[model samples]
Target: MSIKALITHIQELVSAQSGLAGLNLGLVNYGVPTKLPAIYIDGLTFLDDKLNSHTFNLCYVTTDLSIEQLDYAKLILAALQGSPCVQAQQLLPRPEPENKRNRWIIPCVFFPRALKA
Candidate 1:
């Protein structure tokens, strides 16, 4: 799906809230390879009332997949890199699984354009 569509969907899933929080959801038939079966996301960062800095805490969720872990990671990283608003992107430590399954969580932060000095 297009980035615009994805963003819209995310906004809907998370709903309108006042605070810093993340939202995690799945992405199916995303036109990507099998390695990347799900799309984990955190809450979106937006300018707060103060207009001094962005407000929103990071959140994450995982989805089941039928592909190599490394490949999935690569796809997510690539997608984030392509985005214009994302910055200081990085992956967090892998979480331990309760059962035998393949999962990956890609964490990233979005920083809006700063005012010109």
Candidate 2:
């Protein structure tokens, strides 16, 4: 399946599992209204697994309330990783800007992989 299709499926799965209605899981933040207690998942990428030729990298950004909520989000991400659609999963920290000092910035991507051709 294509990476776009895979991402859509992952978003659907997450929404269904988290009981979130009308969640928009797109690459760009287009002012989607999210209810509190909802988790935001983004920055999904697929890359070559450098250590293993047979596998690929599935990286994404997960942001939520607290550490516990982040853990839950990770669990949800882990479940998605187990699917055949994904080769492997890696949890990457979203990079913070050097100047702007907002410690509570929602997770985002610094370096993202290009879509496979």
Candidate 3:
């Protein structure tokens, strides 16, 4: 799938989740927002020369200091795993936020039909 399509898929998945309705979601270029519980499309990488295999990051930030951060990651994984295009997904190390927020990135890979062969 294309990058735009992948982004749309992520958005749809997040929206369909149980408790993410009020969360602030955006793209990486939008910069660090003042809102809590935010998600961004941080980065995208093509794993192959043909762009058929791709990996992207879901950057999630929140002010809550508890393990609630993991819920978002799990929700993302659950949604992505249902798609045929998705090959794998992983959670990266939690990064120190600029302020008093918890930040993490969920990386996911997609192998389009062209590369499924």
For all predicted structures, in order, the TM-scores are: 0.43, 0.39, 0.69
The RMSD (Cα, Å) of candidate 2 is 8.3
Q: Please name the candidate that would achieve the greatest TM-score relative to the true structure.
A: 3
Clashing pairs in 2: none
Candidate 1: which stretches are off by over 4 Å? 1-36, 43-67, 112-117
**Residue lDDT tens for model 2, 3-112:** 44544554555655542233333432222224333333344433434522222223323333235434544655555554444433445444334532111223222111
Best candidate, lDDT = 3
Better of 2 and 3 by lDDT: 3
Give the per-residue lDDT digits (tens) of candidate 1, residues 7-52: 4433433333322123223332222324323444444345443543
Q: How close is candidate 1 to the true structure, as a TM-score?
A: 0.43
| TM-score of structure candidate 2 | 0.39
lDDT of each: 0.40, 0.38, 0.64
What stretches of model 2 exceed 4 Å from their correct place?
1-3, 19-65, 95-117
- List the RMSD of every prediction in angstroms: 11.1, 8.3, 4.0
